[model samples]
Target: MTTPLLTLDTVACTRGGVVLLENVSLNLLPGEARIVQGPNGSGKTTLLRTIAGLQPPSAGKLQAEDGAIAYAAHADGLKGTLTVAENLAFWASLFGTEDIETAMSAYSLLDLRNRHAGALSAGQKRRVGLARLLVTACPVWVLDEPTVSLDAASVELFADAIRQHLGRGGAALIATHIDLGLKAQVLDVAAFRPAHRSDGAFDEAFL
Candidate 1:
């Protein structure tokens, strides 16, 4: 039996008291991925954040099957003072792992192992973030614009990594504008666009 990793039923997200997305429903299963695509203000980030537990959904229910999710945002979450190896090692430890070498080579970062994270460029730092995903074994990956600073080759490397993850029975939920080199179910946030109301009679403070 195939168990869904996550499920969102009539999910609605809001920012600044304004609805961004509403009535979104999706099922994500193991070895599967769903790519979120939409305009800049289409609430793509909000949807991913809401599922990642970083933000609260304005309405509807979100359920997770099992295991904690590994979230990698646009930020690298690196400590400038630490070395490339050190930063990844720290994250691995938190996830109950210590093998950093495997992640280092995922993005061709083995050579930069000893380099200070502060000295790496934006792209290098982005690779470091991608490596963090592999440093530990997580069932679900929630990525937002993960390939932003990566080059073509790096993007391919990331794609290959994602394939490997799916092959190992993992699932991913990604919000990206670029091609990730893998076919996935596409969700257009615009479909759930909120209806504009001008009456302004309801007060949200009550909720």
Candidate 2:
């Protein structure tokens, strides 16, 4: 069997006396993608955040073979005053690379290169955010609702980028409500939801 880029074994998401999910386990292998789907209150975003190292798992083991994660969540992670190309260039530079053209081309952002991030529409901003993943060159991606605010064509573009990323032996853990043509394996966070919370912190927000 191929080595897994990321591993989560019997992970539980608990906090402040609440149990959101339990007994969650998965192996993210190279070139593989996993779709995390659930209802509004389900812990989809929680799971992705846990895998991304943004949040610590309340229980169980988490490991990564590649030890890198490129994560994008609800926030677009863009500077409003900066242009599309500027944002990408900044991230690329931070990642120790200087080639921003490839990422812009992948997301069809060439036309918006001069456009300020805040001035662009939601879909345009989403494209820019998605493009940052490619610029990072990280082998694993953890995305939460990456398709939010994207139009049909833009979604298709994002899907193609994701396909190409996986084609390069990258792995992804995505939590999304809309389909992005990824052909990913399914992981429904609702399946691991606890019947009740012990600490009276029953509320959990969705991404």
Candidate 3:
């Protein structure tokens, strides 16, 4: 049997001391993609954040290899003054990788390689940000609304990159509303939301 790259056993996700999701469990294996689906405030982002180690889970068991996950959130995580190539180079070096050629080519960033990230449009910046995933050399990807500022073409580019990553035995957990045209498994957060708030404290966090 193939070992799972990530596993969450009855995990609970919380934000600002409020439990948004409880008893959520899932597993990601090699060459698999799982899409998280939920309405606004369904704890999708919180779930991803917990899984990416950005925040601790409120409860339950979570397991994954250390330094095995590459996360891309709503923020582009770019240096305004650095050129696209320089940004990628910085990440590549940080992750012990030296190749940025394929990553740039995959996102059609060869043309914007010389431009500073701050000068690029929202979509352009998003493309460059997503491309960073390629250089991290991690086997697990955890993304939150990766297509936020991407256009149709750029979305296709990102989807193709993911497909290629899966082809190479990588796994992904994505949270997005639009379809990326991949045969990905889906998880709805509604199932994990508590049926009733026992404390009666108003839940205001954006889940």
Candidate 4:
């Protein structure tokens, strides 16, 4: 069998001396897409950050093939001063790739190439961030609320791009509250909640 693209074993997290999650385990195989759904403050963002290696888990082991993952967060992470094309060019350079133009065209951002990212609307900035994903040859994508400010058409475009990625043997972990219209395995964080708290108020230190 092929090796799983990602594995998390007995993971736990604590923030500000509070336990956010405990004993969480997951394995993601190539070409798989997992949707993480939870109500507000359910550690959904924390889980994504942990998987992306942005935040260290308080305990447990998380492993992945080096350089195989790319993470896109709710914040577009764009430089307000940089033009859309310049921003993509910078990311592509850092990744040692040169397909920025292709990505821009794919996302229909070619016409807006000269516009500063901050000047664009919320949806446009999201598109710019999403376009960065295409320039990388990474196999794993971790997206946090990728469709937050997108229109219906842009949402469809994003979905289509993700479908193509999966078709190319890539895996994805998405934290979203809405349906992304893709074939994905659901990972409901609600199941991991402690039994005592039926109020739906997530304690930061459940782990």
The most accurate candidate by lDDT is 3
* Model 4 regions more than 4 Å off: 194-207
Clash number by candidate, in order? 0, 0, 0, 4
RMSD of each: 2.0, 3.2, 2.5, 3.4
TM-score comparison, 1 vs 3, better candidate: 3
Model 3 quality (TM-score): 0.95
lDDT of 2 by residue, 23-118 (tens): 998989999999988998677777777778877888899998544898899998899999999999999989888888999999999988999999
1-207 in candidate 4: lDDT tens per residue? Answer: 978899989887554445567778899898899999989887888888888888788789999998889999988889999999999999999988988987888789999999999899999999999999998778999999999989999998899888989998899999887788999999987666543533443554353
> TM-scores of all models?
0.93, 0.92, 0.95, 0.91
Give one digit per residue, the lDDT tens place, for model 3 in 1-207: 999999999999877757789999999999999999999988999999999998888789999999999999999899999999999999999999999999999999999999999999999999999999999999999999999989899999999999999999999999999999999989999999987654444453434
Q: Model 1's lDDT to the true fold? A: 0.88
Please give the distance, in angstroms, between residue 199's alpha carbon in candidate 1 and its true position after superposition: 9.6
Q: Which stretches of candidate 2 lie over 4 Å from their true place?
A: 200-207
State the displacement of the C-alpha of residue 26, model 4, in Å, after optimal TM-score superposition.
Answer: 1.2
Compute the lDDT of residue 188 as modeled in candidate 4: 84
lDDT of each: 0.88, 0.86, 0.93, 0.86
Clashing residue pairs in candidate 4 (N, C-alpha, C atoms within 3 angstroms)? 18-205, 19-204, 19-205, 19-206
Ranking by TM-score: 3, 1, 2, 4
Error of 1 at 184 (Å): 0.8
